[model samples]
Target: MKKLLLATLLLLGIVTTASAQLPKVMLKSIDGKSVSTDTLSNNGKPFIIDFFATWCKPCNRELTAISEVYEEWQEETGVKVIAVSIDQAQNINKVKPLVDNHGWQYEVLLDPNSDFKRALGIQTIPYVIVCDGNGKIVSKHNGYTEGAEEELIEEVRKLVNK
Candidate 1:
């Protein structure tokens, strides 16, 4: 029974590790500066990476809701939010304006080529990935509803306690 339990636990560890891996890919910042997941440092802070497009309404709503409590979230958990725009070349130019207009306090990145999106196997927009201090994604939630930010808060809290 002990050996069986050990094996099951080992398998669960492997599965969790695989699911939390984030690819190291280069992307452009809202200011046109180059940024990469490899260099995404937050002083050992938990953060959320959200993939959205300018035209994605749910994405807009999610950002809006998150923005409402973002400052509080940061103060509580030292968590940060990174908004990655999956806008194609045609709509890429609008990303900065949209971000600025909303005054969202997040590090916005432009994934115009969708390379980051493709690497993650993302099928839709408004995808949220919560990562730990070491950049390991601890939780993933697809789509958004009214209270999705609360769900994200739970994940971020887990990271904080760890």
Candidate 2:
């Protein structure tokens, strides 16, 4: 029990510190435009930055699950979800089609070289970072499972209320 509490605190500290500053890295748009990831702000609205790839089944599942309730989530907390594709350069071409075909409504950005991933120390897809309105990371989790997005929603609620 103590170990679990300690780990939770450690995770909270990680997010609190890391969310203060957005990383300066360029991400590609579907129109072949280079966008600085740091400029991807929510204008004082908390948001979730999800690192995913075109081929990751779990990542797709998580995003799909969140998408189902995203409208309500946004209405309640004023939060947005930013989809960051860490697909390699070779597979980068698939991102736009996948997002469009799936009808995902979030801001989709491409990280062909995974520079943002490396800078954020994200070693895996389906990684989630919840950031506050000021761009301070409040919570983070790796991987996804059923009911996981519920915990994420709670995190956003906490920060939005703060």
Index of the highest-lDDT prediction: 1
Q: Which ten residues in a row have the lowest lDDT in candidate 1?
A: 13-22
Local accuracy of candidate 2 as per-residue lDDT tens digits, 1-162? 999999999988776666566789987777778889777778898889999998999999999999999999989998899999999989988998989888889988888888999988788879998887877666679999998999999988887776
How many clashes in each structure? 0, 2
lDDT of 2: 0.87
Candidate 1 regions exceeding 4 Å error are 1-14, 17-19
The CA lDDT at 156 in model 2 is 85
Q: Scored by CA lDDT, what does every candidate get?
A: 0.88, 0.87
lDDT of 1 by residue, 97-120 (tens): 899899998999989889999888
TM-score of model number 1: 0.88
The Cα error of candidate 1 at residue 103, in Å, is 0.8
